[model samples]
Structure formats: structure tokens, C-alpha cells
Target chain A: MDSVNPSSKYKDTLSLIIFIVVVLTAPLWGKFIGAGYPDLLQKFAIFGLFAIGYNILFGLTGYLSFGHAVFLGIGSYTAAWSFKLLTMNPVPAVIFAVLLSGIFAAAIGYVSLKRTGIYFAILTLAFAQMGYNLAYSVLTPITNGETGLRVLRDDPRVLDNALGVQIDGSPVGNFFGIEMTGYSGYYFCAIMLILGFYLAMRVFRSPFGMKLIAIKSNQTRMEYTGYNPRPYLLAAFVISGMYAGLAGALMVIVDPLAGAERMQWTASGEVVLMTILGGVGTLIGPLIGAVVIKYFENIFSAINESGLHATFSFLPEWLENIAVTIVSPFVGDGWHMTLGVLFMIVIIFMPGGIMEAIRRLTAWVKRMRG
Target chain B: MEDNYVLEISGVNKTFGGLKALSDINLKVKQGTTHAIIGPNGAGKSTLLNTCIAKLVPDSGSIMFAGQDLTDGMTPHGINQLGVSRVFQTPEIFPELSLLNNVMIPALAKRDGAFKFDLFKWLRNENQLQDEAMHYLDDLGLADSSDIRAGSLSRGDKRRLEMAMCLIQHPKLLLLDEPTAGMARHDTNRTIELLKKIKEGGMTKIIIEHDMHVVFSLADHISVLAQGAIIAEGKPDDIKGHPKVREAYLGTAEL
Candidate 1:
């Protein structure tokens, strides 16, 4: 019988330690690989947060919601509005985004979960598309449509000014008077990632998490056993939505601009891809998936024909031409093609994703040692 | 005895579109007695049990369990919370979860109904809840497979695990739909024995079965049905000799 996770009691603690070590020292390790820029690290942590929260619903509860981006876009828009109306501090933006997204998720999840399986997915997808359309048009005053919402200079930042923090200087997101930029911004996002990880871990081991897993396993049995699966599933959805909210808010904090395009169905689809690639039911898989996919988006797409030519310079002209031609279509403007192939391979060969592969490899090594 | 009936259904009628699934059904299952419902296929035995848990709403009449209405708009979980739990014809244990979790779930549900926010609380690795779950598995002879996935178990073992899952809820009334369906004689005998043990503990059981051997062995009271309506209702001995019950359901063909 295939096991869900490590049976050892210390497994949770060990995984937590490993998670903390990797995330805290991410910049140093990332610098070693020339991917250490604060922007990229911040994006990695933010999206990692989004994916973990998402795993709580889709992975744990077997609910594949195609509308998670509604919460994310709302979170981003809320941050922008906060900066425009109230303050440039990231705290309020993060809090407001999480809260609003949670409320939105509760409302959407309540209606969407009326049906199950593909119907549920379609319902969530329809709601998200509706949210996107609204943000793109009807709610243009708040959302600013395609132009998006942005912070303005000399605007009345009520809280900041009341605390005598003058707006005479260039406006920037701050962490209690400290500027949110470069390393500081990345570290703040990383801090949230840690908190998010802790909360996710708690939820996973908790009885609520068990109920979600049980729902996925057999909802019929649960129903006859005196268990109401509706509210528990909604709770997971709301909590996961808040994670997306935090991710969206943090994105604005690092780079202050909210775009209507953030709510697109494709954006929601990316987190689903990330969770699946990293390992759906495990703790660390979603973050690993988020970072990898984002890495491919940033670094792989930037690889040009020239960069390929430079790397393959030692090869014969014909060989180099063949190599570049074969790889070119999978890189640069075709990074998504590479991602699609990777997703297919993972689905076919390792249905449990990369984490399961790693587990199998370690078990093999252990067997060899024994 | 009538006043102490654990489950009482009066003037119940149910239909699907135009086809009558059940009609003019009145049943009173005495407390601490194992009542077996024997019927032909489509005789509405499953439908009758479904109403007890409110899975299907009766067109007319009331399903009263322990003096509380079990029908109308009440959900299945709501009825189960009123100390009624059901086992499906096929085992419905959590397939992906370990056998321990399969049993632990109902135990937890019995302790904390529907929803609980025990986040940050360790749920696995030998807590009191798991201990109680372990006890159920041990009682149902599934102790050796506690760590195994419930899905991987053989059909008989899965049935036993499902029984363990339902039993852990400590439900006052147990509803079994074809409790020993599609099992070998050995497995069927084991299930009958398990039910007998449970009955000895003073739990009221409502079993639906087509197998007369199981019905005669475990049922203290029996109800025989044909064409969605009860034809005979009596003790197992009286039901065995009833000419209508034998002619309608248990023909010499099955005997």
C-alpha cells in the first residue's frame, strides 16, 4: 500500500527545519546560481505562498478550483487602493488583501461547492471569469481596467501623516519606517513565507486537515458517518484564498502596481500546475514547484539564440546549428512549451510529481545501504 | 416494547418519478434487537434504510428515531448525529487513507460532529482518539492491517474495516444494507458472528439481506417484503413458516 507521508514522528519536525533552512538562506544559495536578485526571490516566496495555500484545497481536499486568481487579483487591487488612499506601509496592504480575499473565497466557495467533480471546477472557473470581467470593465472606477490601479504622489496617506511621517520624499512601501526595496523586500516576503509555511503545516496535521483529506477520499462515507463536508471544504478554500491574497499583496509591496490581467484564468491555472509539479499532498512540493516554474519563466525565457550559440561554441557548425534549432523552440519565446512538456512527463511518469520521485530515490538509496 | 422501539416508521410512501419505490411502509424496530429485512431485489429494502438516514425523502409519512424526526429536510449527517449510522452495500471506507484513519474518522466524528478546528493539534501517532480507533480495529479483527491502505485490502477485509468504521461511532441504531452481500460462506459466517457479538452489547441493528441463512442466524425479528411492500412481519421462526413470505420471496428456487 502506498503511504501518504513519512510514518516517523520526527518527520514533521525534520521537514520544518529543512524548510526554514532553505527559505532563510535562499538568497545566498540563489546568489551562487546567479538568480539572487531580490525581485526574483520575492516573486519566488510570494508565489510559493500562493501555491501552498492552494494545496490545502486542491491537494488535501481534492477540490480543483479554477478561480483562485479572483482572490489574488483582489488582494493586489486592495493593496494598490490602500497605498492610494491610506498609507504606503506594506502591513495594511497584506492584512487587507488577506481579509478581503478570504471573504471573497467564502462567498464564491459556498456557491461553487454546491456541485462536485468537473461541475465544481466549472463553477469556480465561471466565477473567476466573472470577477476578471468585472475588474476589466464594470468596476473600472476601482480597478482602473487595463490601465490598472497605482499609487499616486502627494496623496493623503492618512495614517502615515498622522504619525508625522512626511510625504516630501519619494513614495515607497515601508516596513515600520524601513524602506521596502531590494534585500529588505525579499526578506519580508520570505518572512511571510515562513509564517505561511507554519500555518499550512499546522493545518495539514490538524484534524481539520484530516477531514479535508477524508472528504477527498470518500465523501459519501463521511456523510453517513455524521460528518458535514461542506463547511470544512469552505474553510480550506477561504484559508487558501488568504494565501493567494498575501501573495498578491506582497507583489504590490515589492513592485507597487495592480493589473486587471492578474485575475485571468491562466494565472489561476499556473498555481494549479505548480502544486501538481511539486507534489500535491506533501508540505514542501508546492513551493518547490512555484520556484522552479518561476525560474523557468524568468531565466529560461531570457536565453536567446546568441546565448545558446555562445554556450555551444565548441561544437561543429552543423552540430551547433542542429542543437540550437532543436532547443530554441523550447526556450526564449517558447518557455511555455518546455513547461508543458515537463508537466506531461511528470503526469505520465511520476503522477505524485517530483517529490514522489525524490522519495523513491531516497528509499532506493536506503535499500542499497541496508 | 412498542414504546422502546429504537426506530419507528409510520405510513411512509416514496416514489421515483412515477415508479413507486416504497409504499405504505410501517416498521417498528425494537431496542437491543437485531431486525433483519429480507426482500427481493428492488423490493425497496435499500430505500427503506435510506429513509431511516434521510438519504431519500418519503413522499409522505415520518421516520422517527429515538422520538426525533429523521425525515423531511434533515441531511444524512444530521440523522447520523442523532445516533444512527449506516454501512453501504459495498464498503465505503476511505480508500486512500490507512485503515487506522478509516476507523479513526468515524470515532472522531462521533466525538466531534461535522466540523472541528483542531488546527495545531497533533492528530496522529497514538493519541487518545487513535487509541479509540485502534480499539475498534482490534475488535473487528483488523488490527494487523491498521497501517495498510484501506483500498489495498481484500474485499472481505474492506467490509470488516467498513464495519469497524461504522461501529466506532457507537451509534444507538445501526443500519446495514446487505451486510454480507457477495461474500464467501466463511466471510458471511464471520460477519454474522460479528453482528451477533454487537447485538449482545445491547445495540439495535436493522439489517437488509437476501440471504436466509444470515437472516435466520442473526435476526431476532424479521420483516419480509415483495414489490416494495411488507408481506410478513414476525419473529424469525414465524417468518420461516409463512406461506406468503416463502411463495413471494424465498421460493424453492433459492431454497
Candidate 2:
């Protein structure tokens, strides 16, 4: 029961250095090899933010939320509405999205946190489905129905008007002189992703975070020690929701559309899958999973059956077609089948996820070096 | 009636369905004394201890600690904040977290209220918190095993670590549920010595024990329970010689 020594300060500094390197170099790599697929990389970074936030609740608290996509959808819809009605400035729109998501999360968390384990997961899923149904039918007027909402050239921007600029098609009206497209948009999300990572790291190291772990470990003991665990659990849920909101806002900023599909339970399940694939609870694991999954979805899906056959033409014709047929289901719309198989394998063989496997490998290497 | 009496339980009754787990259990322990509750099997010793600490609510009872009516509605976190801590019969340390972190939890909660949302604050840089935790671990002779997982500890070591966790909170009342329930004789002796040292160091403790030798050696006041009622209460010698106590325990053997 001795005091644990502080983890090496250099460990954090080193991680920061590595993060900076990756953020700076990734877009450049995308530019060189992705063949006009910078959007793919940007989308990966945005979803990486979402997955990281989702992991805060799922990985750390040992609570699996199946409706996290509702927060993401709410954030996107709120930001879209803000841009359409109030202002076209991305700053306030993003802030409003995050705040709205926080309020939404608080409401869901307060109700859902009364139950634990599978019940809690079902409650969250039920809420998310309710949100999805509302967006699709009940709230069609505000949410613009299944067709979603869009910003037009005539949309009023009071701030832009007050600043003596034209309301429509003006180059001077960019967000702090950086256009919300291409590299600038990618950088904006990349910066926010780093900040989100920093905040999550802080929570991981905080006493409140430890209390969440305590609740996860022995909730009965936590109660006996005089803690009402509901508040802590709710707080974690809300913070995670805000993270989802930021990612959602970034999505609308990059492409000014918010659809009901974003709120679907499948999106929620995708984030969970990403987190588990990369390593739930590890700092960079979810981000890695997000990038990997999005990369497959965006780039790998473009490789159709004919594309596979063209690449494998050096082999015998029968062998080439057989190889193409064998791999066809995993290339295009069937990519999800491959993802499902990969997830099952990971769950069975590496239950701790890829991050844990990496950690074990690193420990073994260190032992050998020593 | 002493000002420093750490715990005061009056008219505490607990009924589980049709059975009375505890009934009208009134007890008080002065500061810096080792109070022991002993009883035959099913005597409600554990239930009484649980009720005092708000683990189980009594149907019609009040528990006062440090001059406050810490009755049925207060939670365990609420009681811990009022300077009361408990060690369970089974080792309840965080199995995955290192022993150091397990002890740090209660210590942190004691220092930083019942709840704080300081998600960005660094726990390691909290110098005062680390110092206090280290002091308790040093006293418990667990300084060497601080980084090891608490679940991996020997039974005797886990008990010591659990005690250390409770002690670090600087509780006014320490409730131990069978501190030596499943230990070897040597380990039991060591636990008795630890309790003795804790009492000498000015911490009030209430121990629920079945071991008569340990009870007689340490208790300043003894309460014997039988079938959910306090059948005898006195000095250890008086309870040992009481005819009813013999009948409850020895069952026809002459004392």
C-alpha cells in the first residue's frame, strides 16, 4: 500500500512529440499516395475523435453504450441548424453543438445510469432509437425529415452582415481567413482531435477518473465508502457525449449536411467496434481503429471485383477469377463482412484488443533488452 | 457518554423478510479503544456491524457518529466523509489496480470531498496526498508491495493492506468485519497485534470476531450476541463465566 510513484514525466512528453509528428505527417502522406483522397484522411480524423469519446465511457467505465450515435447526430443537426438560422461561423456552431450534446447526454445518463450492465446498454440503445425515430418522422419539421438540412447562399449571417461583408459567395468571409474545405478543414479537425485527446488524457490521470474505475471495480465498496456513483457515471457519460458532439459538428462543417442515418444504432455500434479493435481504454487505440476502419471503407471499397482481377492478371485466368471471387465479398459493400470476421477474431483471440497485444509485445521487448 | 466516543448505535433493528437479523442493538465505543462484538453463529454480529456503517438499514434505529445522527439514509460515502471507514470480511481491494492505487482511493476521497469533477488535475502531483498514503503503508509494513496488485497478496497481507486503506482515511471509527476470519494462527496473532497497535495509536475500532482468544486479549468491552439479540454484555471475564453465555456457546459443558 505504498504510494505509487508518479509515472515518468518523460512518457507524456514523448507521447506528445509522437502525436505532433503523426498529425503533421499524416496529411502529407495522404496527399502523396491517396490520389485526391484527402477527404478520406480528414473523415478518419473526425471519426477518430468520435471513437475516442465513445471509449471514455465504454472502455474506462466498463459500460457499453449502444446509442452514442444519437449524440453525434444531435451535434451535427444542431450545428447545421445554427449555420442555417443564426450564423455561418463554425466557431459558435461547434460550441453550440457540443453544449447541446452535453445537455442531451445529461438527460440520457440520468435515466439510463439507474441500471447497470446489459440493462444500461439497452436503455441507451432505446433512447438512441427513439432519437432516430424522432428525427425520421416526429421531428421532421425541425430536422428537415430524412432528406436532412442544407445551408443556402441566401442564409443570413448577421455577423458577416455587421462586419460589412456580402452575405453570399465571399472569399473574405472564411473562418479566420481559412476556408472550411480541403486542407484548412482537415487541420481544424486535426487540431480539435489533438485537444480532445489531451482532455481525455487528463481525465484518465485525474482522481475523478480513478473513482470511475473504483465504481467499475467494486461499486458496492464505493457505496459503502459513501459515494453515490450515479453522479460520477453520469458525468463520464456527458463528457463522452460532448466529444461525440464535437466530432459531429466537424462533420457538418466539412460537409454542411446532417442526415438521420448519422443517428442510427449501427453508427453507434461502429464506434464501439472501432474502440475494441484498436484497444479499448488505451489512449491512441480508438483513433487507430477509426483510421483503419475508415480507410477500408473509403479507399479499399473502391477496389471492385474487376479491379482485383486486373491486379491479379499475372496469374492463370481461372486462378485470377477464382482469387477475385474469393476476395469479392471483402472489397466493396461486403467490406463490413470482413470487418465482422475481424472483430470476432479479435474478441476471441485478443480480448484486450490490439493495444493490449502491443503492450505485451513492448513489455517482452523491454525484458529482452534488459 | 464520553465526548470522544467514536460510534453510538441505539435501538437498531434489522429484519430480513420474516427473520430479525438484528434487534435493538445498542452499543457505543469510546475513542482509542478496541471494542469487540462476539457471538455464536447466526448471532447478527455481521448485520450489526453493517447497520452501523449504513451498509444495511435498520427498520427502527439510529446510528450516531462524531455527534451526528448517521442513520439509515446516509450512504457509505457519506459515512466515510464523517470519518468512519470499514474493512470487509472478504478482501475488497481493487484487484486490477495496484495496491498503492487501492489505498490512494479512500485517501483521495477523504482529502478531496466526496466528489470532485477535476478531470484534468494530476493525481500524482498531489504531494500531500502521496505523503499521507505512504505513511500509512509504511506503518502497515506494505511499502514493499505497493506496486503489486492487491489480489495477488497473501491472505494475511491482504488483510493488512485493507486495514492500511481504512487507516489512511484517518477515520474516527474503524469497523472491521472479522479481521482474522480465515487466517493461520500466526497470521491471526499478527492481526491481533496490528489491531492492538492501531488502538494504541489513538484510533477507535470495533471488531466483530468469533475467536475467543483474540477477543479476550484485545476487547475493552465485550458484547455477546445469540439469535439476533445481545444476550450478554460485560467485561470478557464476566461474559466468559456467565451461565447463559455458556449455554449459548458450550451447550451443556460446565464452565
Candidate 3:
């Protein structure tokens, strides 16, 4: 009918390859050069999945949610219950996590999407806060309050008992016979992260995804064009919520506990920080954001005065002391200060986040080479 | 009555806090003709268009389009489904998307109703809709800019892309709200030529325009509105020298 245009499938394939290579080598990166990665690396993959999910809703659709953590919490709680009631197998837990979280998200998104902009954000936040409070106080029978719902030795795990309790000391989440703990746990999460990224990529390129982004760009335009975005938005909300739940289940599979603290408003805010900090709309940006924040939080904060001294030992004593004094605030108990400064600097200089900064840097280097 | 007229507005009244944006306005566009509503500023041309498109509900009136009573809380989406496509005055579009994407969305909306889960469906699988959208884009002379971001287009091009988006639906009734506003002469002429080409297709057109040149050249019938009411209604030649129409335009004394 009309004319022609170029396509972008090849670029997507290349990016997918790069993503797989980098994530598959997570255990071999820098300080993680040992046989088994510290639990922190698992945190990277887990929260990375969560942030990717959040990006689908907020970044792709422009639905800024202040309560996505509730999906993760619901997932965590559901996984814990599955372990205690039905089985200790990670498969059942992951499936249940996604299913229950999706149902809950649908119910909440239906109500929240009635209003848009700040009001939508507030509605989701209120729903999440209510869920958190219930888990902390009212729903203690199910959530088990602050200590959270954990599997005990006496839990009537029907599936496990039916198969006969062959393992020692309570139960461990397993896939067939392989335990989901230590190195295996990291491996499990890494695989899930890769799969999640692939699915997210598909969504980004799909017609449905285009509709969501259209709604984000101009809802009024979309309406006049004969597209009602409500059902599509609700679907995206549920899908992303399922991703959060999957991450939650993975967390429990790795650590075997779900706490009320996991559902707090701060937790929701943390995922928001990760999504925006990496790059609001870029595919790989949320993962990078998750890594940066987790690295600062779990690893950098552990750097003590002696650790700082070792790093700056080559300097003269006066300069070394000064370096330690300055660096110390950015590490240990004051780690959040480093993050705060980073957030401010990134917002001021690169409002598009780290991904934009990286893009510019690469372009500059390319120019220099030319 | 149903066979002759495509849009019928009866007893429509809309008041914005005593401003009386539109009051008791009644108009009918015969099937397959280009009808223009020409009015001075503040004469409620835009307001009446908004009410017809369901962007604003008339305080009291019935909008009947394609045998559907559209006055009962019908949404814009609902109105659009009845084969009514509106070209806004300001050229509203999905600015962040590619020109191809901007066109494809309307095609898909026509094929897939208001919403479809369609989450896993590959973009490549939408070959039919894509081809249709490309046809419209090419028709509008925007095939070369198909891959460019819609927001990056010039004002004229953006308006053209918006028309391509609306045209894909093959709407039975097209409501254009000042389609040639703020355009260079070349673009305005190009638009008029495009409209002339579309006129052959026999879709009823309702154009609310301030540009008398466009109104006289393209419109088969013209209605002159002022102070929230139609001051004159006749063929373009008849309306040109109508006494009340001249009075409204030049604010001449009754004598």
C-alpha cells in the first residue's frame, strides 16, 4: 500500500546474547571469583527480576506504582505456605507464587486503575500498606506476624510426607533431589532471571506492549483512536505482579523465610529506586540498577576503617587518613548516604539514569576513536 | 431520515459555568458530502466538535450516529467505534512512538477492538494490520519517515501522520477540528488536495474550520455560527454574501 521501513529484530537478538553472557558469568565477576558466590549475588539476580517486572508496569506503561513490593510479599508468603502445606519442592512454590500474586494484583489493579497519575500511585500504595499492616497484625494467622511464616519440622507437608521425609533437619526447597540452597540456589535464580528477561523482551516488542506504551504517551489520543486501555493496563499490572511473585518465591527458596519487613513501604520504594536508578525504560537498565544498589548496600557497606586503609595503604599517612575519613561515610553504616548522593547526582546530571550515562559515554568513546 | 444523514444533533446545550459554550445547536450532515462549520473565535466551534466526539457531554441533547444514540454517557472510545474519527486542532499523537507504530496502533484497534491481551502475539504476525497501516502512511506521503519518531516530525508531518492513523480505520464519518490551522500555504493546499481525493471515496466529512479560503474551496455546504448559534446555513456561494454572516464576520452595523 504505502512504502517501506527498517526493522530491529537483529538488534534485539544481539542484546539478548549479551545479557545471557553477562548473567551466566555472575559467579566469576570481580570479587565473586570463588567457587560459590556469596548470597549477595543471588540478591542481584532476584531483585533484578523484580525491577525488570516493575519496569514493565512503570517504565513501559508509565504506571508509577508505589506498592509493587506487596506482590513480592504475597509471592513470598504464598511460597512459604506451599512449602509448609503441600510440598518443599521449589516447582510447586514458584507456580503458586505466580498464580496467587497475579490474582491479588488483578483485584488491586482493577481498583487502582480507576484513577490515574498521582491518585493511582496513592491507591496502589494504600493497598500495599493495608496488606503490610495485615501481615504484621491482623493476618497473623496466615502471615504469622513479624517472625513471618516459616516451615517447621512439624509442618504437615503432605506431598513431602507422602514421598517420605528422606532429608535430615526439617526440609529444604528442592527441584527433584537437588537442594535450592548455596550454589544451587544462585544457579536457580540466575536461570529464572534469564528466562524472565527473555519474556520481558518479548513483551517489549509485542503489539500489546506497543499499546501499553501508547497509553503512556497519550491516553486521550488512544481513546479517540478507538482503544480503551483499561483491560490492557490491568493485564500488564497482573503480569508484572506475577514476576514480582516469582522473585519472592525465589527469595524464599534461597532463604526459606518470609517476613513482614519484606512488604513494608520502604521495600516498595527500594524497587522503585532500582528501576529509576538504572534507566526507567531501558530493557537492561533495571538489572544494572539492582546490581549497583545491592553492591553498595550488601558489599560496600561492609568496608570498615581497616578495609579502607588497605585500599589506600600506598598513600602517605596524612592523605591515607583523609581518604579513609571521606570514603568511610560512603561505606558501612553510612552506605545509604553514598546512595543518596548517587541518586541526587544521577537525577541532576542524567535524568534518564545510568543507562543514559553509559550511552553517552559510549558515543563519546566512539567519537574519540573516529 | 437515517439513509440521508450520517450525524444528527438535536437540542444540544452545553454551558461551562454560565459561559454557554453551546446552546440548542442543531445540525445534520448529509451522507457523502464535505460540510464545514465556519465561525468566529468564541463562537463554540471547537466546543460543539468536542460534544459531538463525546469529549464533552452536552448538558441536554441527543447525538445520533449510525443509528446509535450516543448521548447517554458514551465515551470517546465508544463514539470512535461508531466509525467516527476526529482530527484534533493541535495534532495530538503518540509522540514517543515511531511513525510506523503510530499508524499501526489505529489499524490494530480497528482489527482488535478496544483491547486484546495479545501479549505473546509476535509483531511480525500482525502482517495484515501492518500492511494496511503502511498503505495509509504511503498514501499520506510519509512512507520515508515511517521509522522516525513521530514527535520528531514537523508540525505538518505530525498532522499528516495523525490523518494516516485515522484513515486506516476507514471511518464512515470523519470529524476534522481545524485540520489546516497554522499551516503554510503549501501544506494547506496539500491538505485540501488530499481532502479532495478523499471526497471521491464518499465518506461524510464534518470540518470545523476558521479558514474561509479552505471553507469556500472544499466545502459542499457551509454553516456559519456566531455567539453559540448558527447565523447562516446555505451553499458556499449563497453563504458568501448572506447579510447576517457578513455582520457576524465584520461586526457591521445592522444598516
Candidate 4:
């Protein structure tokens, strides 16, 4: 209905193609920035999917959930247990993760959605905290407690054992005998991210997406306009949860571990930061946000005193020392501080997130060319 | 007898704590007629509209719209799906969306019912709905700025956009709550014109108005409320000269 300009649909297709190309070739370009490693690249793909899913709920419906990490944790746990009991095939694990987490989201969303605005946020947060604590203690038998749930040799991989498959090494995620590790793992996650991005794009362009945006803009108006906002909101919540679940499933697929720490409030907050930083409501914004944050966590945090010194080695001895001291806290273990500052800058200046900045830049460039 | 009326409120009573917001109120709006509810501030005119839309529940009464009871635990959206569309006192448009999208949303709601998981159905594919929305926008004189965000429009434009939003739904009944609340005389007349145009479609309309200009021009019948109860009910001419109605407004001053 918003297709006033005829070429907008064409633009969307072009954007999707560009997004696919960029994501698929991440490792190639990632090498340029010292992020070529499969583990870190896989993190990019996985978290990108997570943030994209989170955007569907928060960015679309404006129901800022503070507990999506619980879904992620649930997915991880489900997939890990699937490996232990059902099979090592990544397909079933992914399916179970998505289904279980969607159910959890439906239950939690039904309750949490009863209240809107800040109350909704607090309710979701409380439910997530309850989930985290339960997993850490009361649900220890299922979750495997502090050690986290891991695929074990002694456990029955029903399908694998049924096929007379032997245990190879430390019980990694095997997809039809092909190891889901290294570059293969990154590609698998990348493929998922691409598919997820496409689905999100479809949602964004669909009438359902318009309804979600309408709910976000004015939920009261939406209700009066002859639409039930509750179901739409719950649907968005469940869809987003499934996305987080898929992300979690991918996490354990690459690493084969489900930890209680993944469900923490901080992890939930991190996705929020990613969505806001990338540009809420825009399709690729969340992915950009996810990659930036993950990149900071993996690469920026690894910058030690020596690395800083090496970068500033051209400066005089005293100047280099001063520079190192000034920047040290923002790098390495204090990387989150740098992230906080970046978040502030994005919120203060580019409230629409990095996507807004890019839009502004392009508009300015067009004006200059004119 | 009940089949003759499009909307019937029988002995509806609503109280906000100790304040009797509405008491023993009964209104019957006939099919294909414009019924106006006029009252001084705090007379529960809006509250009545709220009840009609299921936004507010009458403490003890039945609001029957087209043979269905609105008070029987029906949600606002469900009542809307029953062909009841309203323009609120202050225009309730989706501010962040384009005017076109704002209009299309209600149309989608009407066509798709209250809830449909049409997630994959692209909006671009709904060419017919888009054309209809554009037609309504053009009717309301908002087509020129249809691409602009609804929030950026002037108050009068926003009101008109909200009208287009409702008009696109082609609802069986339309409720206008002070559709010209804070508009200039120029814009007010324009809104009156738009309301009159929609009236040709013979949709049953219940309008709550303070402006007698709007009331006289659009209303076929009128109900006057004073202190949460109807003081007069008749044709427009009868309501215009009713002593109780004049006193309700001018407070004992003979006109």
C-alpha cells in the first residue's frame, strides 16, 4: 500500500541481493579487518540472525522485550539436548529449538503482552530472569547445571546410533557425516542468516508488517481500526523468539554447548543495543548492529597494551604512552565502555541508528551531485 | 421493531465511581440516517461513543448494534469487525506511517477480518486495495500528500486523513466524535462537506458534535444530553428550538 513510487519494490530486490552478496562474502572481506576466523565470522552470522529477529518485535511492534535472550538460551538447551537424545543431525535440533522456544514465547508473550509500554518490558525481564534461574538451579537435570549441557559420548544419539555411526572425537555437530565446524559452520550460519534476512524483508514488505508498524505507531488506533493488536503482537513475539531460538541452535551447532550465561539479562540487553545501534525498524540495521557489537566483543576486546602500543609506535615514546593510557580503557577488557560511548553517540545524534546516518549521507551526496 | 434500528442502546447506565457519567441512557439510530448526539462538556457523549465501540463498558445496559450486543464481552476490534468505525475526538491516525498506509490499514482490517496471518502476502500485490485507499484519500483531499507521514500533516489534514482511513473501510455504521473539534471555519466546512458526501452512501452515522453548524447541516435527527441524561430528542428543527436544549446551553437565557 505504501508503494507510491513504482521502483521501490525494485529497490527492495536490489537491496536484498546486495545484502545476500555482502553476508555471503563476509569471510573474504572479514579477513581485511583481521576477522577472517571461522569462529568470529560464525558469531557474526548467528548474532546477525538474532538481532534481525529481535527487530521484528521491538523495531516493528515497539514492544521492547527485555528477555529475548531466554528464547536464545532455550534454543541452545533444546538443540543441545536433541543432540544428546534425538540425533546429531542439525535439522531436528533446529526444528526442536524453534518449536520449543516459540511455545515459550507464546506463553510468556500472552502474559507479558497484557501490559504495554514499560510494564511489558519489566514482565518479560522477570520471566527471562525466572527462566535463567530455573535453568541454573531447579532445571539442572535437564540443563546440566553450571557445567552447561553438552553432547556426551555415553548418551544415545538415537538416529546416529540407529544408523550404526561411531563416536568420532569429542561429539561435535555432524550434519549427515559432514562436520559443522570451521568454514562449513560459518557457511551454514551464513545461509541461515541470509534466509532469515529474506524472510524479515518479506515481513517488512507485507501487510502483516504494515499492521505491526501501525501497532507500533499507535496501538489504540490499530485496535479501533478493526484489528486485534494482541494477536499481532503475540505473533511478532513468537516469530522473534523463534529467530532467537534458531540463532541459539546455530550457536550450539558450531560449538556444541548450551550455557546458562547465554540467558542473562546482559545478553538480552546486548541485542537491544544491537537493534538500536544498527537502526530499529530497518531490515539490515540489526544485522549491522550485531556485526559491530560482535566485532567489538571479539576483536576490539582482544587489543592488549602491546597491540595499542604497536598502533601508536610511530609517535614519540612519551606521546605513545599517553595515547595508550588514554585509549587503553576503551579497548581490551574495557571494550564495553567504548560500546557505551558509541551507543550514546548513535542515540544522541543518529537516533534512527546507523541506517539513518547512511540515509542522510546518501541524500547529502545526491544533493551535492545535483 | 428492533430490526428497524441500526444501533439500539436500552437503559444503558455507566458510572465512574460516584459520578454518574451516564444513567439510563437509551438511543436508537435508524438505518441510513444521521443521528447527532449533542451535549455540553462532561455529559458522557464520548463515553457513549466508547461504549458503542466497546472501548468502555456501560455499567448496566445493553448496546445492540445490528442485532449484536456490544456489551457481551466483545472487544473494540471485534465490534469494529461488526462494521462499526469511528473517528475519535482528537484524530487517532498512525502518526509515523504515510497517509496512504494509514488509510490502507483499516481497509486491510476490514477485508482480512480482525486477524489474519497474511505475513507473506506483499502489500504491493494489493493493487486494488491501494487504488481504493488512494480514491478515499483523494476524496478527503489528502491524496496530494499521501506519501508524507500522517503526523507531519496539519491538524485539519490529520482529521481528514482519519476520515479517509474510516471511509476506506466502508463500514456499515460510522461514528464521528467532534470531527471538527479544533479546526478553522474553512476546514470545518470542508469536513462537513466530506461528511455529507459519505452520507450519500446511506451508512448509518452517529455524530457527537458541539458545533451546531455541523449538527444542523449533517444531522437528520438529534439527541440532546444535559448532565449525563437526554434532555431532548427529535428532528433537527425540534432540537434547535427546544426550550430544555437552549437552557442546557445558555443556562435559562431565552433565545
Q: Model 1 TM-score?
A: 0.95
Q: Which CAPRI level is candidate 1?
A: medium
Report the C-alpha lDDT of model 3 over A3-116, residue by residue, as the tens digit. Answer: 112336686788889888888777777355332354987899999999999998998889999999999999999999999998888999999999999999999999999999
Model 2 alpha-carbon drift over 4 Å, by segment: A1-5, A31-36, A167-173, A311-322, A367-370, B2-5, B250-255
lDDT, ranked from best to worst: 4, 1, 3, 2
Report clashes for each candidate as comma-separated counts.
Answer: 0, 7, 2, 0
Query: Candidate 3: deviation at residue A209, Å?
Result: 0.6
The true-versus-predicted C-alpha distance at residue A352 of model 3, in Å, is 1.7
Error of 1 at A200 (Å): 0.7
Q: Candidate 1 lDDT, tens digit per residue, B186-220?
A: 88888888898998999999999888888889998
Any idea what lDDT model 4 has? 0.90
Q: Which of the numbered candidates is closest to the native, going by highest DockQ?
A: 1
Q: Model 3, residue B64: what's the lDDT?
A: 88
RMSD of each: 2.2, 2.8, 3.1, 2.3
Chain B TM-score of candidate number 1: 0.96
Q: Choose 1 or 2, whichever is better by lDDT.
A: 1
- C-alpha displacement of B136 in model 2, angstroms? 1.3
Cα shift from native, residue B11, model 4 (Å): 2.1
Q: What TM-score would each prediction reach against the true structure?
A: 0.95, 0.94, 0.95, 0.95
lDDT of 2 by residue, B78-196 (tens): 87888888889887777767777888888877777777787878877877877777777877778887777777988777887888888888788888888887778887887788778
**Cα shift from native, residue B185, model 1 (Å):** 4.0
**Ranking of models by DockQ:** 1, 4, 3, 2
Q: What is the DockQ of candidate 4?
A: 0.72
